[model samples]
Target: MNDVKPRPAGLRAVPSAVWALGFVSLLMDVSSEIIHALLPIYLVSGLGASMLTVGLIEGIAEATASITKVFSGALSDWMGKRKWLAVLGYGLAACTKPIFPLAGSVGWLVAARFIDRIGKGIRGAPRDALIADVTPPHLRGASFGLRQSLDTVGAFLGPALAVALMWLTVDNFRAVFWVAVIPAFLAVAVLVFAVAEPARAEPTRKARWPLSVAELKRLGPAYWQIVAIGFVFSLARFSEAFLILRAQAVGLTPMLVPLVLVLMNAAYALSAYPAGALSDRFDRLTVLKTGFALLVAADLVLAFTNGIEGVIAGVALWGLHMGFTQGLLAALVADAAPTELRGTAFGMFNLLTGVALLVASVLAGDLWERIGSRGTFLAGAALTVVALAALAATKAAGPGDGGSAEAASTKEP
Candidate 1:
């Protein structure tokens, strides 16, 4: 008889800290999505920006966050601390919330966006590392999945709220933006009050200059492999703003533009946990492969279909792919990196991938401008094929590969 019985299944098994952090993410996402859902149209129609400029801005904002993550993550390692850094990051972001409603020009909006992302950069790695710190190895996938699912819930909820507010305000973007600020602050409050850092068994040892070559070398080849694959995946995916632009191109009204994200996020939120839990049980790489294939399917759908219904189908697929891929990648990083260097590993991974996203978004904008939305999405499909090929080639290289889930866990959970 097996006297040890089993741990609680699903969410009950995850630590309280992970749940609190997920709520923090959910609140912040709700705040951010409300603004983001409307921002592309606001920049184009209200502030007189062009498609290339929109792409440039979005790319730069994300890149800034990724770049900042490197320093912030390294700092967290050097200090042997995670929670306070996360708190500071969330606070900074919350402070930037009001600026969106107050901005009168593109420059103001850009400045606000840049600062806001810096805050995200500051928090992103530390928070992720914290999740790894608290979660048991056996439950890593489920923990990440639950957090992602909750965060995505806010992702859709925010846009749904934005659509409702848009109807009520008669399409006042500023009013909707003002409303977004509340959740940003609430997210900060939750992080500060509800989440607590886990106690380590050993005394905290600081990594001297965590960004140094020696320190990076400690992250090992497995981590680097994940980073490379992540970069390729980013190139194939690009920014979500393009989805809104595509909807608009196909005659979606400004008032209903946010519905695009609402639909996409609904798919993402629904699938993220199930996909993650499934990965924990089966092979993660295989699930990720299916996700890559889904992206390919999504891009092809968007490329060929001219009707709104087709665009809707493509966007939903896009969301589903996100669900299957994003959290799994994070869990892989936690699986690959040294516990002490998890922050730097996540930061470096994000840095490379964020650069790829910049390149992809700018290229997508240029293609859309020159050849239309169809050409842009067709190009995306082509890139996804290349990424999928790269992934398959890696798997073909044999067992003990950097991304092999089986390699990481030799025993049953």
Candidate 2:
């Protein structure tokens, strides 16, 4: 049977709420990426932190966010609302931007980063669930892709701005950070003023307890499978901070290091929407497999080549793999989870993957300190092969075979 109905064609078909959310993500990413692009260098050079310290800090910050997502996502479900939680999360993150410039030590920055990620955790699952709630299944892939694409636009733009600003200010990191604050508040304003949660149908029931055994069992085997794949995938991909560090190690001056993120995210922004749209017409797993292979290639390039050109090529491949996989993975989670549990599903997925990332980042840092960048990336490549094997094993159970039946009942207009 045809699971999706014929709908309006192209981006026009996507709901306005999705666009509003995308812009919110775009603005926030702009604010965050500015600090992020410069943060590793700042930690290592400015604060005199070690590579392992950076890794631990990045890993812990993300793990904190992922852990927080479970609660915030569940709270959204319990309240039967998503918009306000998202707003609060964005507001909190916006508030934290000023702290970056003022931070006097690694400890202060760590606190700010931890709090910022808590805000990220709070918003991520609910915002994603909101997207799934508003968009039709037929357009789900495109809608997620659009948001990813727009968010990535800010990702590159922030670094590009950082590059220019650094030059103009003679490498004034704090000045660039101060400029980053504007877009963050703009993100909050847009979320508050432009986006409205669509009305739920009658008989809307609050989830009794989103994390209980019964509720989790309701998420089903397919959802669990996706989670497993996500965990492994995250293992293969460590924090992007490593990418910035890699560029710096290869003789890219401090002022120009942000260019690395600029290049990578440019490719990511360019590819995300097309990749999502492609997944809509074909097997998402196939597209994801191609992405996984690209990561392997990227890792090899980064590991073997020691020049700036090699770093550039590796970064581009990394971004391409991100574009191919991230949104599709999100869409798959939406496909596999029950409608009422979408937030919880996203939360759980992120939590596991976030933990994996923590492990990967720590291991990468250890390797980088011991055997150098080559060892770190070569390890990543090996892990990607393992993740690919897991993905291959998952192919036997398609996205349709999961919780789609239950989810479809709620999705039908």
Candidate 3:
């Protein structure tokens, strides 16, 4: 611990490329969240879709992206390039932006969502890998946090913009979607021109076959532990669409519903960087435990309370958990996996979590239909208890054990 510097450098001390990547994420999130904030309402109220249908759509879209990430991440490692694949992903997402406004039917929305998520799938692993590639190992948590915080800044901004646009356009969903297309393309432009990929410490040209059993085996048990944790955490946390529904059930207006997201993301953006920096200085697992504790609190609050204020409190806690854990987990992945296979490791992690999310969302939707909103949240709290136990057990097993990434990290302050 004495080997490292005591004080952390400011954001300006990080590489310019990391800043550029953060902005790229920020703009794209601004575009995506603007559409996403209102999508459930649009499908249910405007298109007469069921809550189960909304759950299934959200689940399927994310699963598709998660599944696609494995291939893209592996391909980046195999091809010895991350930027081109990332550019392709952002461009594909930009192309799909116009489809949101043009859609008149459920099928159209589904297809457009599928395509847009494909773009996310393509870019996600590579972009994450690029962040790892560009930053110093010690600063990875902070780098990932900075990028996530910036992305969340867009997350809040997008919903806030949607609220404003809905008021101005008199509830025109299509127009807001139309406006979303601009920033997505702008994100692509910045990535292509502004960010520079750092030279890899090790050459990847020798390994063209990234999916071989030998290649897969190269990712040790430590990496797999991270994947398992991600899946369990994902199960306890389902689609945010349900949060919006809960708010509406509490009598929040259609336009004002987005404020829930704005508030949640505001908490997320505010805490992410500090949490990431904290992980770099402290035991990462201890920080993650705090996140798990917050989720449990959030679910219990949402389950027991019927008021909008309770929902507000729950959503804020949910965002704080997200802020505290997401970037730290990304840093853990970078720490455990071999540098050459970093992209593949992230893809696998996202893949398991993505599948878990689909299951969780579908189950939440079913539970909502069978019981009530309270039942749904209560179920979440129950699952969260299970996850918390698993996390504690993992922590007990020690850092060098398969379950803990602590052995892999460098927390020297």
Candidate 4:
């Protein structure tokens, strides 16, 4: 048997593309977080929209992203291109940010969200594929984790900036949105000037519009099982709007919600890279399972908590859960996929999770309306438990256990 060797530390130096992508993400997230942190309040207090409307908007946005992810990933693979698609996607989203400040009603806000999500859909899979293409397998987890950590640093900083801006403007949300334009444009500029698509090994066969299942199945059952587990986990998870609302319910003022977001993102940014490195050393699946458990605990905590202190603790837990899950899942997907089909694998993973979030948000909204916020929290906790059980059962089934051929295909090339 051939021994799989790890790359030398010097050979694992960060690529220019990684740094460029990280900059683009930082800028984009700064733009996104500024608007997103305040959107629920803008819609609710300013526009008098219902919780259901908030859920609907979130569901639609996620569904739009989900539907487009598969096609975009497959197209990028067929075309053997990544940078142009990424550029277009980021450009579209950047242009859409200004519309939020301009909008006078919920209808326009929804439209802005739709357009923004369309851009997200267009870029996500291709961008992930680009990351995979530029990095080698052994280093893939750490590379992706570094990107996530940097991206989330923006998430932390953006909301902190927004919090300061809100205080400066005396809670004028529109002004914050306007200020967001700067980072959005900067993100686009960075992507255009700094990022490059790496060359792909050409397929021997002719390119087709849609890839076949046979092609996709090469990713293995462990990959699909992980995706399935992600979907279940997503079903319990709703939009961050609910988190903001929960904070509000627990006595946090509207302006202070961004601060809470900053805290969560700080935790996420701090944990992501370390979690990724640990997964690289251990089994990625075990790390992911632990993340799911943390999420379950967060939901349960949120269900019963009412005090500001409790809410803070819950959000912190939620942050820890995000830290553990996000990059780890990406690593798991990379581990399960062939280099050629990695783009499609990511798209499929996102697609499933997106759909799950759409449904979950809608369900959460309805539950919140009917049974109150506590009910929604309980439902999320329950669903997480179910997802955990399924994951355990799948694991118990042994190698080929979860239908992922890639589980047993961990041999390095």
Instruction: Count clashing pairs, candidate 4.
Output: 6
Per-residue lDDT for 346-405 in model 1, tens only? Answer: 899988888898898899899989998888888888888887777776532111132343
Q: After superposition, how far is residue 324 of candidate 1 from its true place, in Å?
A: 0.5
- lDDT, model 3: 0.85
Q: Which regions of candidate 4 fall more than 4 Å away from where they truly are? A: 1-6, 9-12, 204-207, 395-413
| Candidate 3 vs candidate 4, TM-score winner | 3
Among all windows of ten consecutive residues in candidate 3, which has the lowest summed lDDT?
396-405
Query: Ten-residue segment with the worst summed lDDT in candidate 1?
Result: 396-405
Evaluation by lDDT, superior candidate among 3 and 4 = 3
> What ranking of all candidate models by TM-score puts the best one first?
2, 1, 3, 4
lDDT of each: 0.86, 0.89, 0.85, 0.82
Residue 289's lDDT within candidate 2 is 90
Residue-level lDDT of model 4, residues 210-229, one tens digit each, is 36766765667767887988
Query: How far in Å is the alpha carbon of 46 misplaced in model 4?
Result: 0.4
lDDT of 3 by residue, 131-195 (tens): 88777666777888999999999999999999999999999999999999999999999999998
Name model 1 segments beyond 4 Å from true. 1-4, 203-206, 395-413
| Model 2 stretches astray by more than 4 angstroms | 1-5, 203-206, 396-403, 407-413
For candidate 1, give the lDDT of residue 290: 90
